[model samples]
Target chain A: EAGVAQSPRYKIIEKRQSVAFWCNPISGHATLYWYQQILGQGPKLLIQFQNNGVVDDSQLPKDRFSAERLKGVDSTLKIQPAKLEDSAVYLCASSYLAGGPNEQYFGPGTRLTVT
Target chain B: GESVGLHLPTLSVQEGDNSIINCAYSNSASDYFIWYKQESGKGPQFIIDIRSNMDKRQGQRVTVLLNKTVKHLSLQIAATQPGDSAVYFCAENPHDDKIIFGKGTRLHILP
Candidate 1:
């Protein structure tokens, strides 16, 4: 079984620039999540999607951050006019669609650095 | 505003010894708790999990203990090896849906 996959394991950009990260979740998993992990901190949930529908995105910076799960299998998170404070590891995870305790499988995150 | 937090920021243990990482959670409504291990350059890896109804659950070389009364949780690793060195985080799902993660505890194995 393949785990969640992410692209561009690392990225560096100047302040005010734009950056995006891609994620491919495990097959048959209906729940996909994106998280941001700052140095020395645990991953923070940025957004969650359940079968192409936004489940929760309360922590997402609406002014600068946006994400989409078009076909429900893959997702992309974008940050426009990125700021230095946005430097963090963007992680993606997936889990089965049950209601009970769902064990999430994470992908190798994309480390973003804004200069 | 943190629903979960680690008691220790970092812990160093001698290899082959057991290691216990502690965590305190605040949400009494939380029904499920989980522990995750993360390496330096990777995302968090699921270690062990225990539901609110269970006091303890064991895996191959790991165990998760949950104390609902005190809202406390702990992860135990037996015969810790070098490969076990990483940051461990504890998360909880209040409604069995969304999860909140705690600031991790760095576990260092001294060979």
Candidate 2:
């Protein structure tokens, strides 16, 4: 079976510029997640989507970050007016909710370098 | 604001030796615990997971031990290989609730 897929394995943008990352989850997966992983730190969940509806986004910075799970299959995460601190890897994950919450499968991730 | 943390930032072990990585979680409500392996320039890969109801779970050569009383989680790798060199992360979750990840522990294998 294919795993979670993410686009633009690497990205670089100037400070204040806008950048976006795309993700396509595994087939038949019901839950999708976006996470940000800074150097030397674990990935932090930026948002979660159950189908097309958001399950959690409390950690999302609404002022500069936005994400959408269009039709609940493909998802996009955008960062506007990016800051230097935004330089990190953006990871996408998905899981099937069979029986109960299952282990998440992650994509290669998009490395965002804000100069 | 993450409440989970690793006991050590790094661990170096000789190849073929056993390695143990430790994590401490503060949320008692978390019902599920997981361990992930992340290599350079890649996302975290799921290793193994254990539920709160179970104290131990084994997968391949990896074993996860969960202690509810102290909220401690540990991952034991037997006969570690060079490919096992990577950052290990522990995470906790309570179903739909927020999942918290620990800082991470970098495992280095000495040749």
Best by DockQ: 1
Highest TM-score: which candidate? 1
Q: What local lDDT does model 1 show for residue B95?
A: 74
TM-score (chain B only), all candidates: 0.97, 0.96
Compare the candidates by lDDT and give the number of the best one: 1
For candidate 2, list the clashing residue pairs, or say none. Answer: none
How high is the DockQ of candidate 2? 0.59
Model 2: residues with Cα > 4 Å off, grouped in runs: A98-100
- What are the per-residue Cα lDDT tens digits for candidate 1 across B1-111? 548999999999999999999999999988899899999888899888888889999999998999888999999999999999999999998874687999999999999
TM per candidate comes to: 0.97, 0.95
Candidate 2 lDDT, B14-66, residue by residue in tens: 99999999999988878999899999988899899999999999999999999
lDDT of 2: 0.91
Model 1 chain B: which ten-residue window has the lowest total lDDT?
B92-101
lDDT of 2 by residue, A54-91 (tens): 88898899999999997989999999989999999999
